[model samples]
Target: MAGVFMISDHHFGHKSIIDFESRPFADADEMTETMIDRWNAVVGKDDKVFHLGDFSFLNREKTTAIVSRLNGYKTLILGNHDRGRSRAWWLETGFQEVSEYPIVYGGFFFLSHEPMYMNKHMPYVNIHGHIHGQKYEGNHYFNVCVEHWDYTPVAFEEIVRRVVPSEEQ
Candidate 1:
Protein backbone atom coordinates (compact mmCIF):
# COMPACT_ATOMS: atom_id res chain seq x y z
CA MET A 1 0.00 0.00 0.00
CA ALA A 2 1.12 3.54 -0.62
CA GLY A 3 2.07 5.74 2.31
CA VAL A 4 -0.37 8.24 3.81
CA PHE A 5 0.43 11.95 3.85
CA MET A 6 -1.01 15.26 5.04
CA ILE A 7 -0.36 18.94 4.21
CA SER A 8 -2.18 22.28 4.34
CA ASP A 9 -2.31 26.05 3.92
CA HIS A 10 -0.60 26.17 0.55
CA HIS A 11 -2.63 29.22 -0.47
CA PHE A 12 -1.80 28.72 -4.09
CA GLY A 13 -2.18 31.76 -6.36
CA HIS A 14 -1.84 33.92 -3.30
CA LYS A 15 1.00 36.38 -3.78
CA SER A 16 0.99 37.08 -0.07
CA ILE A 17 2.81 33.84 0.75
CA ILE A 18 6.09 35.47 -0.19
CA ASP A 19 5.34 38.86 1.30
CA PHE A 20 3.28 37.91 4.36
CA GLU A 21 4.78 34.51 5.15
CA SER A 22 8.22 35.42 3.77
CA ARG A 23 8.23 32.30 1.64
CA PRO A 24 11.16 31.70 -0.67
CA PHE A 25 9.28 32.29 -3.89
CA ALA A 26 9.00 35.63 -5.65
CA ASP A 27 5.43 35.41 -6.94
CA ALA A 28 2.23 33.40 -6.63
CA ASP A 29 2.86 31.46 -9.83
CA GLU A 30 6.37 30.57 -8.79
CA MET A 31 5.18 29.58 -5.33
CA THR A 32 2.44 27.41 -6.73
CA GLU A 33 4.81 25.61 -9.05
CA THR A 34 7.33 25.10 -6.28
CA MET A 35 4.70 23.65 -3.98
CA ILE A 36 3.48 21.30 -6.70
CA ASP A 37 6.98 20.13 -7.41
CA ARG A 38 7.62 19.48 -3.76
CA TRP A 39 4.38 17.59 -3.30
CA ASN A 40 4.99 15.34 -6.30
CA ALA A 41 8.50 14.54 -5.11
CA VAL A 42 7.28 12.61 -2.06
CA VAL A 43 3.64 11.73 -2.75
CA GLY A 44 2.91 8.58 -4.73
CA LYS A 45 0.02 7.92 -7.06
CA ASP A 46 -1.98 6.17 -4.37
CA ASP A 47 -1.12 8.18 -1.31
CA LYS A 48 -3.84 9.77 0.77
CA VAL A 49 -3.29 13.46 1.51
CA PHE A 50 -5.36 15.46 3.92
CA HIS A 51 -5.13 19.14 2.98
CA LEU A 52 -5.98 21.13 6.10
CA GLY A 53 -7.20 24.35 4.41
CA ASP A 54 -6.59 27.35 2.19
CA PHE A 55 -5.60 25.27 -0.83
CA SER A 56 -5.67 28.19 -3.19
CA PHE A 57 -5.93 31.94 -3.38
CA LEU A 58 -7.66 31.67 -6.73
CA ASN A 59 -11.19 30.80 -7.64
CA ARG A 60 -12.74 27.32 -7.76
CA GLU A 61 -11.79 26.55 -11.36
CA LYS A 62 -8.14 27.28 -10.97
CA THR A 63 -7.93 25.61 -7.57
CA THR A 64 -9.69 22.49 -8.75
CA ALA A 65 -7.44 22.28 -11.77
CA ILE A 66 -4.38 22.34 -9.59
CA VAL A 67 -5.85 19.78 -7.24
CA SER A 68 -6.55 17.45 -10.17
CA ARG A 69 -2.90 17.49 -11.16
CA LEU A 70 -1.62 16.59 -7.72
CA ASN A 71 -1.05 12.99 -6.74
CA GLY A 72 -3.20 11.16 -4.19
CA TYR A 73 -6.76 11.22 -2.97
CA LYS A 74 -7.12 14.64 -1.36
CA THR A 75 -9.35 15.68 1.52
CA LEU A 76 -9.95 19.25 2.62
CA ILE A 77 -10.93 20.94 5.86
CA LEU A 78 -12.48 24.31 5.15
CA GLY A 79 -10.42 27.20 6.41
CA ASN A 80 -11.75 30.52 7.72
CA HIS A 81 -11.11 32.25 4.42
CA ASP A 82 -12.31 29.43 2.23
CA ARG A 83 -14.81 30.33 -0.49
CA GLY A 84 -17.76 27.96 -0.60
CA ARG A 85 -17.28 27.69 -4.34
CA SER A 86 -13.99 25.87 -3.83
CA ARG A 87 -15.58 23.20 -1.64
CA ALA A 88 -18.33 22.63 -4.17
CA TRP A 89 -15.77 22.36 -6.94
CA TRP A 90 -13.64 19.97 -4.89
CA LEU A 91 -16.50 17.47 -4.71
CA GLU A 92 -16.24 17.02 -8.46
CA THR A 93 -12.48 16.61 -8.35
CA GLY A 94 -12.14 13.62 -6.01
CA PHE A 95 -11.80 15.64 -2.83
CA GLN A 96 -13.90 15.37 0.30
CA GLU A 97 -14.46 17.85 3.12
CA VAL A 98 -13.88 16.67 6.67
CA SER A 99 -16.54 18.31 8.77
CA GLU A 100 -15.82 16.23 11.87
CA TYR A 101 -14.05 13.05 11.00
CA PRO A 102 -13.71 10.89 14.13
CA ILE A 103 -11.64 7.83 13.48
CA VAL A 104 -8.40 6.34 14.80
CA TYR A 105 -5.70 6.24 12.19
CA GLY A 106 -2.06 5.41 12.89
CA GLY A 107 -2.84 5.95 16.58
CA PHE A 108 -4.06 9.57 16.34
CA PHE A 109 -7.08 11.74 15.94
CA PHE A 110 -7.35 13.51 12.57
CA LEU A 111 -9.04 16.87 12.78
CA SER A 112 -9.11 19.28 9.84
CA HIS A 113 -8.98 22.45 11.91
CA GLU A 114 -8.37 22.83 15.63
CA PRO A 115 -11.22 24.07 17.73
CA MET A 116 -10.90 27.31 19.71
CA TYR A 117 -12.14 25.85 22.99
CA MET A 118 -13.01 22.46 24.32
CA ASN A 119 -14.15 21.12 27.70
CA LYS A 120 -13.21 17.49 27.01
CA HIS A 121 -11.17 16.35 24.04
CA MET A 122 -9.80 13.21 22.51
CA PRO A 123 -6.54 11.79 23.82
CA TYR A 124 -5.06 11.86 20.32
CA VAL A 125 -3.52 15.03 18.98
CA ASN A 126 -5.53 17.11 16.52
CA ILE A 127 -3.65 17.31 13.22
CA HIS A 128 -4.64 20.58 11.63
CA GLY A 129 -3.74 23.77 9.77
CA HIS A 130 -4.52 27.61 9.85
CA ILE A 131 -1.58 27.78 12.28
CA HIS A 132 1.84 27.08 10.88
CA GLY A 133 5.10 26.31 12.77
CA GLN A 134 5.57 29.57 14.67
CA LYS A 135 1.87 29.81 15.48
CA TYR A 136 1.91 26.39 17.14
CA GLU A 137 4.65 27.39 19.53
CA GLY A 138 3.69 27.90 23.23
CA ASN A 139 0.15 26.69 22.59
CA HIS A 140 -1.01 23.54 24.35
CA TYR A 141 -2.65 22.29 21.14
CA PHE A 142 -0.86 20.93 18.08
CA ASN A 143 -1.17 21.74 14.37
CA VAL A 144 0.54 20.17 11.40
CA CYS A 145 1.81 21.97 8.32
CA VAL A 146 -0.55 22.10 5.37
CA GLU A 147 1.97 23.58 2.99
CA HIS A 148 4.52 20.80 3.04
CA TRP A 149 6.89 22.27 0.45
CA ASP A 150 8.80 19.00 0.61
CA TYR A 151 5.75 16.81 0.97
CA THR A 152 7.14 15.66 4.32
CA PRO A 153 4.70 14.10 6.72
CA VAL A 154 4.81 15.25 10.33
CA ALA A 155 4.45 12.42 12.82
CA PHE A 156 2.26 12.35 15.88
CA GLU A 157 5.34 11.98 18.08
CA GLU A 158 6.61 15.41 17.05
CA ILE A 159 3.27 17.03 17.79
CA VAL A 160 3.03 15.25 21.13
CA ARG A 161 6.38 16.69 22.13
CA ARG A 162 4.94 20.19 21.93
CA VAL A 163 1.34 19.62 23.04
CA VAL A 164 1.74 16.82 25.55
CA PRO A 165 3.32 17.32 28.94
CA SER A 166 6.77 15.94 29.80
CA GLU A 167 5.29 13.54 32.32
CA GLU A 168 3.22 11.97 29.59
CA GLN A 169 6.18 11.69 27.29
Candidate 2:
Protein backbone atom coordinates (compact mmCIF):
# COMPACT_ATOMS: atom_id res chain seq x y z
CA MET A 1 0.00 0.00 0.00
CA ALA A 2 1.11 3.54 -0.63
CA GLY A 3 2.32 5.37 2.45
CA VAL A 4 0.04 7.99 4.00
CA PHE A 5 1.67 11.11 5.38
CA MET A 6 0.65 14.45 6.90
CA ILE A 7 2.28 17.88 7.05
CA SER A 8 1.37 21.54 7.45
CA ASP A 9 2.45 25.18 7.42
CA HIS A 10 5.13 25.01 4.78
CA HIS A 11 4.76 28.74 3.94
CA PHE A 12 6.93 28.37 0.90
CA GLY A 13 8.21 31.61 -0.73
CA HIS A 14 7.17 33.55 2.34
CA LYS A 15 10.35 35.24 3.44
CA SER A 16 8.90 36.44 6.74
CA ILE A 17 8.14 32.88 7.81
CA ILE A 18 11.86 32.23 8.17
CA ASP A 19 12.17 35.10 10.61
CA PHE A 20 8.84 34.48 12.34
CA GLU A 21 9.33 30.74 12.76
CA SER A 22 13.11 30.96 13.14
CA ARG A 23 13.49 28.50 10.26
CA PRO A 24 17.11 27.81 9.48
CA PHE A 25 16.95 28.69 5.79
CA ALA A 26 18.87 31.65 4.45
CA ASP A 27 16.05 32.73 2.14
CA ALA A 28 12.71 31.74 0.67
CA ASP A 29 14.29 30.12 -2.36
CA GLU A 30 16.61 28.07 -0.20
CA MET A 31 13.79 27.13 2.13
CA THR A 32 11.61 26.10 -0.79
CA GLU A 33 14.32 23.96 -2.38
CA THR A 34 15.30 22.34 0.90
CA MET A 35 11.70 21.60 1.78
CA ILE A 36 11.09 20.05 -1.65
CA ASP A 37 14.17 17.91 -1.30
CA ARG A 38 13.19 16.83 2.18
CA TRP A 39 9.64 16.04 1.09
CA ASN A 40 10.74 14.00 -1.91
CA ALA A 41 13.16 12.07 0.28
CA VAL A 42 10.35 10.69 2.39
CA VAL A 43 7.27 10.73 0.16
CA GLY A 44 7.10 8.54 -2.91
CA LYS A 45 5.27 9.51 -6.11
CA ASP A 46 2.37 7.23 -5.26
CA ASP A 47 2.12 8.17 -1.60
CA LYS A 48 -0.78 10.17 -0.24
CA VAL A 49 -0.03 13.34 1.70
CA PHE A 50 -2.48 15.33 3.72
CA HIS A 51 -1.28 18.93 3.94
CA LEU A 52 -3.11 20.49 6.87
CA GLY A 53 -2.70 24.06 5.50
CA ASP A 54 -0.68 27.18 4.60
CA PHE A 55 1.09 25.22 1.90
CA SER A 56 2.70 28.20 0.17
CA PHE A 57 2.79 31.98 -0.13
CA LEU A 58 4.10 32.08 -3.68
CA ASN A 59 2.35 33.26 -6.79
CA ARG A 60 0.27 30.89 -8.89
CA GLU A 61 3.00 29.87 -11.30
CA LYS A 62 5.63 29.41 -8.63
CA THR A 63 3.22 27.63 -6.31
CA THR A 64 2.20 25.25 -9.08
CA ALA A 65 5.81 24.62 -9.96
CA ILE A 66 6.71 23.82 -6.36
CA VAL A 67 3.71 21.57 -5.94
CA SER A 68 4.57 19.70 -9.12
CA ARG A 69 8.08 19.10 -7.88
CA LEU A 70 6.92 17.42 -4.68
CA ASN A 71 6.22 13.70 -4.57
CA GLY A 72 2.76 12.66 -3.39
CA TYR A 73 -0.91 12.67 -4.15
CA LYS A 74 -1.67 15.82 -2.22
CA THR A 75 -4.78 16.77 -0.30
CA LEU A 76 -5.12 20.19 1.29
CA ILE A 77 -7.19 21.21 4.28
CA LEU A 78 -7.38 24.97 3.89
CA GLY A 79 -5.92 27.12 6.69
CA ASN A 80 -6.58 30.74 7.62
CA HIS A 81 -3.92 31.96 5.23
CA ASP A 82 -5.29 29.64 2.57
CA ARG A 83 -8.47 31.69 2.44
CA GLY A 84 -9.27 34.49 -0.09
CA ARG A 85 -8.50 31.97 -2.81
CA SER A 86 -10.85 29.93 -4.88
CA ARG A 87 -11.05 26.14 -4.81
CA ALA A 88 -10.11 26.16 -8.48
CA TRP A 89 -6.97 28.07 -7.59
CA TRP A 90 -5.85 25.36 -5.17
CA LEU A 91 -6.77 22.62 -7.60
CA GLU A 92 -4.73 24.33 -10.27
CA THR A 93 -1.81 24.34 -7.83
CA GLY A 94 -1.91 20.48 -7.92
CA PHE A 95 -3.78 19.40 -4.82
CA GLN A 96 -5.90 16.36 -5.56
CA GLU A 97 -8.44 17.43 -2.95
CA VAL A 98 -9.17 20.59 -1.02
CA SER A 99 -11.43 21.14 1.95
CA GLU A 100 -12.40 24.09 4.09
CA TYR A 101 -13.77 21.97 6.93
CA PRO A 102 -12.40 19.25 9.14
CA ILE A 103 -12.50 15.66 7.94
CA VAL A 104 -12.73 12.47 9.93
CA TYR A 105 -10.23 9.94 8.71
CA GLY A 106 -10.18 6.20 9.54
CA GLY A 107 -13.05 7.01 11.88
CA PHE A 108 -10.48 8.04 14.46
CA PHE A 109 -8.58 11.15 13.34
CA PHE A 110 -10.21 14.54 12.97
CA LEU A 111 -8.11 16.44 10.44
CA SER A 112 -8.11 20.23 10.21
CA HIS A 113 -5.84 23.19 9.63
CA GLU A 114 -6.47 24.64 13.08
CA PRO A 115 -6.50 22.64 16.28
CA MET A 116 -9.84 21.71 17.73
CA TYR A 117 -10.69 21.30 21.37
CA MET A 118 -11.37 17.74 22.41
CA ASN A 119 -11.05 15.91 25.70
CA LYS A 120 -9.74 12.44 26.52
CA HIS A 121 -13.29 11.18 26.65
CA MET A 122 -13.65 11.78 22.92
CA PRO A 123 -13.14 8.73 20.78
CA TYR A 124 -11.30 10.62 18.08
CA VAL A 125 -8.11 12.67 18.05
CA ASN A 126 -7.46 16.02 16.31
CA ILE A 127 -4.54 16.02 13.93
CA HIS A 128 -3.99 19.63 12.95
CA GLY A 129 -1.59 22.56 12.49
CA HIS A 130 -1.68 26.43 12.57
CA ILE A 131 -0.15 26.69 16.06
CA HIS A 132 3.42 26.56 14.77
CA GLY A 133 5.67 26.28 17.84
CA GLN A 134 2.89 26.65 20.36
CA LYS A 135 2.28 23.45 22.28
CA TYR A 136 -1.05 21.77 22.57
CA GLU A 137 -1.98 20.16 25.87
CA GLY A 138 -3.21 16.54 26.15
CA ASN A 139 -2.79 13.50 23.96
CA HIS A 140 -6.00 14.20 22.07
CA TYR A 141 -4.24 16.91 20.04
CA PHE A 142 -1.40 16.31 17.63
CA ASN A 143 0.35 19.18 15.81
CA VAL A 144 1.63 18.43 12.32
CA CYS A 145 3.20 21.81 11.57
CA VAL A 146 6.60 21.80 9.91
CA GLU A 147 8.02 23.29 13.10
CA HIS A 148 6.76 20.43 15.25
CA TRP A 149 7.90 17.83 12.75
CA ASP A 150 11.45 17.85 11.38
CA TYR A 151 10.20 19.97 8.44
CA THR A 152 8.97 16.85 6.66
CA PRO A 153 5.82 14.88 6.13
CA VAL A 154 5.19 12.34 8.87
CA ALA A 155 3.71 8.86 8.45
CA PHE A 156 0.36 8.01 9.97
CA GLU A 157 1.89 5.01 11.70
CA GLU A 158 4.30 7.31 13.54
CA ILE A 159 1.41 9.44 14.71
CA VAL A 160 -0.43 6.31 15.84
CA ARG A 161 2.55 5.12 17.78
CA ARG A 162 2.78 8.46 19.58
CA VAL A 163 -0.91 8.52 20.47
CA VAL A 164 -1.79 4.87 20.95
CA PRO A 165 -0.37 2.54 23.56
CA SER A 166 1.61 -0.52 22.46
CA GLU A 167 -1.07 -2.82 23.83
CA GLU A 168 -3.71 -1.15 21.70
CA GLN A 169 -1.61 -1.21 18.57
Candidate 3:
Protein backbone atom coordinates (compact mmCIF):
# COMPACT_ATOMS: atom_id res chain seq x y z
CA MET A 1 0.00 0.00 0.00
CA ALA A 2 1.01 3.61 -0.53
CA GLY A 3 2.28 5.56 2.44
CA VAL A 4 2.33 9.20 3.54
CA PHE A 5 5.56 11.01 4.30
CA MET A 6 6.86 14.47 5.19
CA ILE A 7 10.18 16.21 4.80
CA SER A 8 11.59 19.73 4.51
CA ASP A 9 14.52 22.01 3.80
CA HIS A 10 16.10 20.06 0.98
CA HIS A 11 17.96 23.16 -0.23
CA PHE A 12 18.64 21.51 -3.53
CA GLY A 13 21.23 23.12 -5.83
CA HIS A 14 22.30 25.46 -3.05
CA LYS A 15 26.01 24.95 -2.60
CA SER A 16 26.20 27.01 0.56
CA ILE A 17 23.62 24.77 2.19
CA ILE A 18 26.17 21.98 2.38
CA ASP A 19 28.39 23.94 4.70
CA PHE A 20 25.48 25.59 6.42
CA GLU A 21 23.77 22.30 7.23
CA SER A 22 26.90 20.20 7.58
CA ARG A 23 25.61 17.91 4.86
CA PRO A 24 27.76 14.96 3.88
CA PHE A 25 27.77 15.96 0.21
CA ALA A 26 30.81 17.62 -1.31
CA ASP A 27 28.62 20.09 -3.22
CA ALA A 28 25.09 20.94 -4.22
CA ASP A 29 25.01 18.42 -7.05
CA GLU A 30 25.96 15.57 -4.78
CA MET A 31 23.47 16.67 -2.20
CA THR A 32 20.70 16.94 -4.74
CA GLU A 33 21.41 13.56 -6.34
CA THR A 34 21.79 11.82 -3.03
CA MET A 35 18.60 13.28 -1.68
CA ILE A 36 16.70 12.21 -4.80
CA ASP A 37 18.07 8.74 -4.37
CA ARG A 38 17.08 8.62 -0.74
CA TRP A 39 13.59 9.90 -1.55
CA ASN A 40 13.01 7.31 -4.24
CA ALA A 41 14.43 4.49 -2.18
CA VAL A 42 11.57 4.79 0.26
CA VAL A 43 8.70 6.59 -1.43
CA GLY A 44 6.63 4.75 -4.00
CA LYS A 45 5.15 6.45 -7.04
CA ASP A 46 1.70 6.41 -5.50
CA ASP A 47 2.78 7.61 -2.08
CA LYS A 48 1.77 10.97 -0.77
CA VAL A 49 4.64 13.25 0.14
CA PHE A 50 4.17 16.54 1.91
CA HIS A 51 7.37 18.50 1.49
CA LEU A 52 6.95 21.05 4.23
CA GLY A 53 9.19 23.76 2.68
CA ASP A 54 12.48 25.06 1.24
CA PHE A 55 12.48 22.37 -1.39
CA SER A 56 15.08 23.86 -3.75
CA PHE A 57 17.24 26.77 -4.88
CA LEU A 58 17.46 25.88 -8.57
CA ASN A 59 15.73 27.35 -11.58
CA ARG A 60 12.43 26.06 -12.90
CA GLU A 61 13.97 23.58 -15.31
CA LYS A 62 16.36 22.14 -12.78
CA THR A 63 13.78 21.97 -10.08
CA THR A 64 11.35 20.20 -12.39
CA ALA A 65 14.06 17.77 -13.40
CA ILE A 66 14.74 16.86 -9.80
CA VAL A 67 11.09 16.53 -9.01
CA SER A 68 10.51 14.29 -12.00
CA ARG A 69 13.22 11.93 -10.83
CA LEU A 70 11.72 11.54 -7.40
CA ASN A 71 8.91 9.18 -6.52
CA GLY A 72 5.63 10.30 -4.91
CA TYR A 73 2.68 12.60 -5.34
CA LYS A 74 4.29 15.75 -3.94
CA THR A 75 2.77 18.76 -2.22
CA LEU A 76 4.73 21.80 -1.16
CA ILE A 77 4.12 24.24 1.69
CA LEU A 78 6.03 27.45 1.18
CA GLY A 79 8.94 28.33 3.41
CA ASN A 80 10.81 31.63 3.62
CA HIS A 81 13.20 30.56 0.91
CA ASP A 82 10.40 29.19 -1.24
CA ARG A 83 8.43 32.41 -1.22
CA GLY A 84 10.56 33.92 -3.98
CA ARG A 85 8.76 31.74 -6.52
CA SER A 86 5.08 32.14 -7.24
CA ARG A 87 2.67 29.35 -6.40
CA ALA A 88 1.98 28.86 -10.11
CA TRP A 89 5.68 28.53 -10.72
CA TRP A 90 5.96 25.79 -8.14
CA LEU A 91 3.16 23.96 -9.87
CA GLU A 92 4.94 24.30 -13.19
CA THR A 93 7.99 22.78 -11.56
CA GLY A 94 6.02 19.67 -10.58
CA PHE A 95 4.58 20.11 -7.11
CA GLN A 96 0.95 19.05 -7.18
CA GLU A 97 -0.07 21.71 -4.66
CA VAL A 98 1.52 24.68 -2.95
CA SER A 99 0.12 26.39 0.10
CA GLU A 100 1.18 29.86 1.21
CA TYR A 101 0.21 29.15 4.80
CA PRO A 102 -0.11 26.41 7.36
CA ILE A 103 -2.65 23.64 6.89
CA VAL A 104 -4.31 21.34 9.37
CA TYR A 105 -3.84 17.60 8.81
CA GLY A 106 -5.34 14.55 10.48
CA GLY A 107 -7.63 17.03 12.23
CA PHE A 108 -5.00 17.68 14.87
CA PHE A 109 -1.63 18.27 13.19
CA PHE A 110 -0.86 21.75 11.98
CA LEU A 111 1.52 21.48 9.06
CA SER A 112 3.70 24.41 8.03
CA HIS A 113 7.13 25.47 6.93
CA GLU A 114 7.86 27.14 10.25
CA PRO A 115 6.95 26.12 13.74
CA MET A 116 3.71 27.37 15.17
CA TYR A 117 3.23 28.54 18.74
CA MET A 118 1.30 25.99 20.72
CA ASN A 119 0.52 25.86 24.40
CA LYS A 120 -1.10 23.24 26.57
CA HIS A 121 -4.41 24.92 26.02
CA MET A 122 -4.21 24.23 22.30
CA PRO A 123 -5.51 20.91 21.00
CA TYR A 124 -3.11 20.52 18.08
CA VAL A 125 0.31 19.16 17.41
CA ASN A 126 2.28 21.40 15.09
CA ILE A 127 4.34 19.46 12.60
CA HIS A 128 6.72 21.88 10.96
CA GLY A 129 10.11 22.57 9.45
CA HIS A 130 12.63 25.36 8.62
CA ILE A 131 14.37 25.45 12.01
CA HIS A 132 16.59 22.55 10.96
CA GLY A 133 17.60 21.14 14.36
CA GLN A 134 15.76 23.22 16.92
CA LYS A 135 12.94 21.22 18.48
CA TYR A 136 10.28 22.67 20.69
CA GLU A 137 10.26 20.92 24.07
CA GLY A 138 6.68 19.70 24.13
CA ASN A 139 4.51 16.92 22.83
CA HIS A 140 2.60 19.54 20.89
CA TYR A 141 5.51 20.16 18.48
CA PHE A 142 7.29 18.00 15.93
CA ASN A 143 10.06 18.97 13.53
CA VAL A 144 10.13 17.28 10.13
CA CYS A 145 13.21 18.91 8.67
CA VAL A 146 15.64 16.61 6.89
CA GLU A 147 18.27 17.20 9.57
CA HIS A 148 16.06 15.57 12.15
CA TRP A 149 15.11 12.57 10.04
CA ASP A 150 18.44 11.43 8.56
CA TYR A 151 17.97 13.72 5.56
CA THR A 152 14.96 11.70 4.40
CA PRO A 153 11.20 11.85 4.62
CA VAL A 154 9.53 10.99 7.95
CA ALA A 155 6.77 8.49 7.46
CA PHE A 156 3.25 9.19 8.66
CA GLU A 157 3.35 5.99 10.71
CA GLU A 158 6.50 7.24 12.39
CA ILE A 159 4.80 10.49 13.28
CA VAL A 160 1.94 8.52 14.79
CA ARG A 161 4.42 6.40 16.69
CA ARG A 162 5.99 9.45 18.32
CA VAL A 163 2.70 11.07 19.20
CA VAL A 164 1.03 7.90 20.40
CA PRO A 165 3.83 6.91 22.74
CA SER A 166 4.07 10.41 24.18
CA GLU A 167 0.37 10.46 24.94
CA GLU A 168 0.46 7.03 26.46
CA GLN A 169 3.47 7.83 28.65
Q: In candidate 1, what are the lDDT values of residues 68-168, reduced to their tens digit?
A: 77887776777665645444566765575443333345665556654343324445555667765444433434556643334344444455566667996
lDDT of 2 by residue, 60-140 (tens): 999999999999899999999898788789999999999989989998999999999897799778999999988788789
Model 3 pairs whose backbones collide: none
2 versus 3: better TM-score goes to: 2
lDDT (0 to 1) per candidate: 0.63, 0.92, 0.90
Which of the predicted structures, 1 or 3, would earn the higher lDDT when compared with the native?
A: 3
How do the candidates rank by TM-score, highest first?
2, 3, 1
Worst 10 residues of 1 by lDDT: 147-156
Candidate closest to the true structure, highest TM-score: 2
- Predicted model with the maximum lDDT: 2
lDDT of 2: 0.92
Q: How much does each candidate deviate from the true structure in C-alpha RMSD?
A: 3.9, 0.8, 1.6
Model 2, runs deviating above 4 Å = none
Model 1 lDDT, full chain set: 0.63
